[model samples]
Target: MEEAEDDLALLVWGQAEQRAAHGDPSFVRGLAAQLAGRHAAALEQARDYERQLAHVIRILALTPGRDSLTQLLRLLEDTPPAGTHPGLRTSFIASLLAEHQLVPDLVATVFDRREWEKLDELRACLFHELLLRGADTGTRGPLRDWTHVRPGWHPLAWLPAHRRDFEADARFPSRSVRGSASGVSSQLPATGRLDPPTPRPSQPSALRDVATVDVHETIVAAPQAGGWGACGAWVFLLDHALTPEQVPALLPTLPMACVAGLGPTDRFEVAARPMDEIWHLLFETASMGGSHTAGVHGAYGRLWAWRSMAGLSGAPADAGAAEVEQQARQSTWFHFEADAEWFHNDIGSDYGIAALSPDRRRIAVLAATDTD
Candidate 1:
């Protein structure tokens, strides 16, 4: 009986692969059902169970039908041990589903079933993938609403509040250029213009006098796209006011008195970036999920990071997004391309942004680097 079962498993997997390759949906659906039945039987008998279950999931991932997805979700919901992290179960399934041609249908079905919380990681992954892939008009409304209603701590919670800005950025041709170590010139808006730096403060503030902001708490609370990384924010009180052209020259001056050293400045090619572009960069970076983890803060991390930067620059803590963005716009913003060496483990992700506050008296540098 064991030998026969093994033969059946091999036959099913071989046929499923062959049919899937040939675009034979009907055959694939039939095989998925067969595997689902085998999964149920294996569960009942407790023999060769895990292998049988993996077969079902593999076939179902390729099927793309609503029924197949439902079955897959049921397996995800019911099979894991009580203490198993939801992310462990959801990551594989989310990755498989993200590639399906019928993503809108799958998303609608998941929403209809009200499985958002139980499958929260899956839902977040789907949303992030959709955004990355450029959600079509039909998909945007529901996705926007999903962000609005999703719990505040959800990684994507920042989407609804900045929908207009995000949509505008999405329309820009440079939006697709992500964290390239070569620098962010390609990601800048078409204008490639920075508002002139705000006039220097009447009285220069001393570095020791600037209020201390807890940047580590703000940036580390969320999971970055490249996996585990280090975040550091510094406040610099400059004797001279900064110009857009001069911001890149300020990197080496940063006091590496702490553990998180300055990033790879020697390798970086820096360029002035508009405030909106920088905001978009922060959102994209924070919203990214690691290879084996979920994006904990999703879109929400942008606000968290922004607020911290604002506090470092002496903006009001309760300032709205517009006010904060305006403040950043008046500052000198620079984006550079280089491995974030401060992380110690480099996985080709290097994101660095520096801003000389509008007052030109204070400079805030925020950098995050990670490995997947």
Candidate 2:
């Protein structure tokens, strides 16, 4: 593992040097400023570093080796050799570390440094990298097992991604750049459209009844092409009947007035007794204000979700949603959001805690801006 990690580090450093040679010198300077605790200068150089950091993260993510884990942890430690390393390289190493499921470990590192709140940008960069990789950030999911002892919100942790999606909605233009808000399309709306259908709350209700619920379910993500464009969707399959006890865990923090049925294919309706209650219980919170519902996602509709996160810098990841869903099965999912770029044209992006059962059978998908 040590040898492999050394080789991995060399590969990353080599790439960084190559990038630095061709890229702006300010990027490297930004790293030095950050290391020296020069916030203003670091912020000024953020854009230059953004591209380089993103590049390193992608390369490291694709590089296969369990040794990367050891190196990642080592980089977090403020040891002698690492202390002597250049700030740019250190930041790049940190970005690589963010590519995996190590939130608890990373947070612990921050705490150990006694710089919990000071490393907001570092944590932000890591969180953003996790999003780019489609990696489950151990912030709010079942894997998240920390208590909040701080005064304000979770320090250094951003709000839930789904909540950020809604906040971003208020900034988006009602109509998309290519289509109307009504989901009109030149081709078949089912197959393609600029705007796709999204689920919404059927009615409003009280808040006390709304709470996070968990249901375990399988979600299959596949590449989808439609008249609108290319995107993806989660084809969820329930193993057994959903119980009322497991409904709220899957829903958002909004009120649910009705129940809906969603299948693997693009067929959704007001689900029958147990299923309707199950979906309603899970999605009602999410449906209160956002475009969350148990609606069938069309190939075009998936594009809307894709657009929601279009501002995300790195290339779209090929990580399996099914794998993420499996992780949700092992961990818990709750409602959460994050800060995002100001895009007035975003459709939707699913970013939040999933309410999944302990067995991973019932899943409440609290989507960000898009629905799948």
Candidate 3:
């Protein structure tokens, strides 16, 4: 009998998914409410076993709500699922809470239930998802609060201090580039001439005396994970301040170690780009990793990119994103364009961005390609 009931629940879930896919939002919502009510009834009768719990989870994912989320978290705490990978379990729960816009509530519940100690995996996953979502939507109030109360190391602990850089509106005034295939032009001059403008007079004359520095020595550290695909950063110090036009000339001088798997730098067509485009790429890369995997590396990728740029620019370790943007604005920026096939063994999807520090003492280049 229980087998038949589980089968029926699965059938209902399939139908609900179909309804949702077919644009029948009203039907899906109505069915979700009905199922939630049944789940609530089961809870009141003290018969809310695993089967019912699974059924409601499916329904709530389709139509997430605060009450449903609280109930699910409480049930999981009371009767943890056996034989489930904690990362997978918590990642799914985090998605539901993020969808329901209940992240703050989840944080409060963690505090109320003292789940941080008992459910460390869930806590880490939830906080990381919050950071990814914050980057996506530019919402930081919850993140600010989380940092103050967050226990132990978090993937995005630097966010609160650097919040100003991630502000989508102010820092990225031009939405022209996001979500458009041609947002960033791939065209480069046939001669590869960058045609850089004269260095601004405001730049200090002292910058001319700075000595060349090794690219690797200036970066903080590369991300330890692989999902980011062919990632690397380099810093170039020069006797004269670096300019947008100077990037192509410096490309060949990059340590073979820096450009090895990325293919010859000559094949990459370069163009000047705004600061907004680079931030979009960083945020998008982070979002992609988190969406595809059940790890904290996505947030790490974003943080590492920011930190690398900060380190090269001589910004204080705790400098906000806005301050970094301010520094970048006074410097030169460029984007490198190439076909994914241009990379070795035809690993498609390549992106590269470089910036000269406002002081012109350093040029930081960050590049990555996605295998997926």
Candidate 4:
């Protein structure tokens, strides 16, 4: 089956075996473009059968629903498809699938006979309306501050759910509020000062600026005026498991090939144009090392990917409001770049070399690095 033929067609799979190894859809446009006469008619007929019943029946037959364990039990109650024998299937799920968020896990563990015996003493707590009785805990904190009907206005019978607004001299006799036996003139305990509110604490304008996500990272000192159009991060291989705090230092190396991201595809969009020679260096670097070995020091082989960004230049809000409108043509993706090439900020092992154009023109250099 084409579905089961997990051959070498996947790039991830192929490269994975090497490093050990190395390494949408869109609809077609134009009605006339797709309608190719007789072939189109034949396709339409076949699709019509599929859109009606053929595809549905095929899917139903194959699933009978066993792609997942939950579905396996349901299907086995009858007798079904090609994937598993019910007995072994049950054991397999009990081992692997039960650990995650599956309901069967709770059913097997928490409700086991031992657990049931422990909770048996609480039988009276179950199957009953839990009417909480006694002095109200309402006088505590926010509950006391919460505005409610002035107390003693009505009989306690008015506590029924739908019973609203106590009547004056009807539900119960109203007493004087200026001086009542229930400490009417006495104020409830003051939880907080109400003095014109402490002139609201000042905001951290400094931190707010950092909190604002500009999505801007200066890729190089190439000086394209507003900023660089793209940026990426790469880790320089960890000799050991690094903690979260140690991560930002290595984020600056992500190359263009990290991933192509969301939205519509454009023939015009590309990580490297023919003129971008930096791309050549990236491709050569990625391909040269089939399997990773010692990078002089043991520190070199542990490198892993972080994240990448590309597509569309942004303009300063103060100066280029007009130019920002042209950026609608840009897009980015993660994991794989579809039809794009890979490249880093430079070629070779120079710690702080500059990025170059395809012709080797010095467009930008590592002016500085921003860790966070």
Top-scoring candidate (TM-score):
1
Q: Is candidate 2 or candidate 3 better by TM-score?
A: 3
List model 1 lDDT by residue over 76-152, tens digit each.
Answer: 66764232332234544454465553766766766543653476656665665555455652345666666656677
Q: For residues 1-372, could you state the per-residue lDDT of candidate 3 as single tens digits?
A: 122456557747678788788898887676666678777887765444544554455455434455766666665667666433322255455544554545556656643424434555555455655555553223445444555666646545544433334434321111111121212122332443463332312222222212234434334333223244556666556677665566654553355233433333235456666655555455444433322332223344455556555554656555776675566557666666543342332322455666777877676666655443
Residue-wise lDDT of candidate 2 within 52-142, one digit each (tens)? Answer: 5544433443343545443433433433122222223433344445433365565455333243434433444454334433444445642
TM-score computed on alpha carbons, candidate 2: 0.23
User: What TM-score does candidate 4 get on C-alpha atoms?
Assistant: 0.16
What TM-score against the true fold does each predicted structure earn?
Answer: 0.55, 0.23, 0.54, 0.16
- Once fitted onto the true fold, the runs of candidate 2 whose alpha carbons sit more than 4 angstroms away are 1-49, 57-108, 115-117, 120-268, 272-372
Q: Please report, in order, the local distance difference test score of every candidate based on alpha carbons.
A: 0.52, 0.32, 0.49, 0.22
Sorted by TM-score (best first), the order is 1, 3, 2, 4
Look at candidate 4 and tell me the lDDT of residue 226. 11
lDDT of 4 by residue, 1-372 (tens): 121224323423443344432221111212223334435777777656544442232233233223343343334334432232211222212222222223323233322334333321111111010111111224443122211422333222122212112111111111121211110111111332121222222221111111012222322212121122233332122234433222222222222223222112311111222111222222122212111211110000000000001111222323222232222112111111221222222312211212222222111222211111
RMSD of 2: 20.5
**lDDT of prediction 1:** 0.52
